[model samples]
Target: MAQEVFWRRKTLREMNREEWESLCDGCALCCLHKVEDEDTQEVFYTTVVCHLLDMNSCQCTEYERRCQLVPSCIRLEPEDVETFDWLPITCSYRLIHEGKDLPEWHPLLTGERSSVQQANASVLSVYEVRDNEISEDQLIDFILDED
Candidate 1:
């Protein structure tokens, strides 16, 4: 019989560092800026992405120092799996945490990291501007049109 993959067999908290890191699908939607409504506390994604994100690659240019550079950056940890509802619906981490299977275009499934961008599901196709190009107050103007 064939063996099940680590992602299907292990919980997010059970995976080793390498396994956990490999779970990321590189969609880079997480790199986009978000705003929370002060009253209802609803989170809204903005089209403005982090200045450190490489538009072409959809990866952070300063991955190691991301939190230090961006004070609002939320570092994903296995312990926070239950709180991943704020993540994008297409996010791998959120999908796995919710007991959903990886999408067909996931690197682990397609064996091609570029499949995400090729599918046009990445932030590359939606982002309007980099955070550095706009003021904090302008983020609301870039809110994604969720339908």
Candidate 2:
């Protein structure tokens, strides 16, 4: 029998749990808080990270309890790809959803976790503060140009 190539092409839903988790580029942009202008419904990104996010790891400190602790936290699903506006432009899930190939910096592509950080895709050294510590007015200043 011929061996199946993993990355030939796979949709979000078609991926198994390990493959699904591997899709995260570890950019940590999704963990940041965002503001939306109700009138225009335009989402604006901020540097304020979720309280649960570990700045060093660029991942939630408490992943399983995120929804319980942060009621507003969004649980991304394959179906929500097109609808969720908060996802970063560089997110692997979003990229796959839009029919784009993963960037070269992605760990899956490079086979190295540090590759994302090296490419500046991971939030390493760039987060500002927990959402609870920052005021809405301060958000404007924390907006990062990293992307």
Candidate 3:
């Protein structure tokens, strides 16, 4: 019998490290800075990104040392998915955790790595501001609508 596709067959918690890593579509929206309301608890996305994120490739420049280099950087794990309200709706991990299918343009589905970019899901062309340059007072200036 043919082997089942890993994503459809295994829950995020059930997937091994390699399987889990392959599920990432590499949009890099997670690397962007966000602001949360103190009382309202609303999360806002911003164009400013982590210094470690490569604007051209939209990948972390230092994947393995991210935690050490940026103490506040969140390394998302299976258990953390459900509670991460800031995850983009197009994120493969968030979609899987919410029992939704990957979008047709997902690399795993289309077998084309550029599909996500072609579909306009990747944030490659978004503003290239860095987190280190932005102050708390200026966060609202970079706030972007989720769409």
Best by TM-score: 1
Q: Give all TM-scores, in the order shown.
A: 0.96, 0.84, 0.89
User: Global CA lDDT of candidate 1, please?
Assistant: 0.92
Clashes of each: 0, 0, 0
In terms of TM-score, how similar is model 1 to the real structure?
A: 0.96
lDDT of 3 by residue, 1-147 (tens): 999888888999999999898899988878777888899998888888888887777788899999999887889898887785678778899898888889999889888878888888877756557888977688789987666
Task: Give per-residue CA lDDT, model 2, range 1-147, as digits (tens).
Answer: 776545445778788878887788778878877777789987877778887877776778888988999887888887766774467888888777777788888888788888888887765556767877977688777776644
Please rank every candidate by TM-score, starting with the best: 1, 3, 2
Instruction: List candidate 1 stretches off by more than 4 Å.
Output: none
RMSD of 3: 1.8
Estimate the Cα RMSD of every predicted model relative to the unseen true structure: 0.9, 2.5, 1.8
Regions more than 4 Å wrong, model 2: 1-8, 144-147
Name model 3 segments beyond 4 Å from true. 1-3
